[model samples]
Target: MANSFSGADMSLRTDKAVQRGPALQFTVDDQLVDAFSGESVAAALFAVGRRELRQSPRDSAPRGMFCMMGSCQECLVWVGQRQVPACQVPVAAGLAVQTLSFRRQHLD
Candidate 1:
């Protein structure tokens, strides 16, 4: 992928860019969290000291976003029943997240 500012100032198109407001909060396991506009799920989690979001079903090893480019499936998290790629998912408001590979009977 190219740099975020590669052609930001040179683009000739008239289309306006989306203006993201202040950090939005999302509830994860009853905990309210903040995520920046250009941040990914894994990045946001790490920023707030959340390391383990899910684990491998067979081994139950910790897993989350790795490589941070959607090339790895380690960052898979449920977004309202649908499995969404966390590394590739942009931070959004009111995002309902669930973990399918969570360790233990229920994650605390």
Candidate 2:
């Protein structure tokens, strides 16, 4: 899979250049992922090829960012104790994110 983020820009369009903030580091499922400031958690994860953010509560099917605008709850993940949409949350330095896959693995 191609990286969704490049240099300081997170836009997939190569023709249009986007200015982004400083770089930051965050953890997803205990794996470190690099992200630029102003990037959403989902964006960072997609950049690193982490497509599945959670499994369906009922079926255990894989789920990832769909709408990316928070309209769909497909990208929900745990940040600390709260579950929030990954596409809606901004990447922060040292932020630890836990996907539902991790939880399921631990429970099993």
RMSD of each: 10.4, 4.5
Instruction: State the displacement of the C-alpha of residue 21, model 1, in Å, after optimal TM-score superposition.
Output: 5.5
Kindly give the stretch of ten consecutive residues in candidate 1 with the minimal lDDT sum: 1-10
Tens-digit per-residue lDDT, 1-108, candidate 1 = 222211233232223774645667665554556665776777767666666778777897887767888787877777765677777777777775666644234653
Residue by residue across 1-108, what tens digits does model 2's lDDT show? 232334444344233577877878787777667787898999877766667887787998888999999999999988888889999999999898888778658643
Model 2 lDDT, residue 36, Cα: 77
TM-scores for candidates 1 onward, in order: 0.68, 0.79
TM-score, predicted candidate 2 vs. hidden true structure:
0.79
* Clashing residue pairs, backbone N/CA/C < 3 A, model 1: none
Candidate 1 structure lDDT:
0.64
CA shift of 82, model 2, Å = 0.3
Worst 10 residues of 2 by lDDT: 1-10
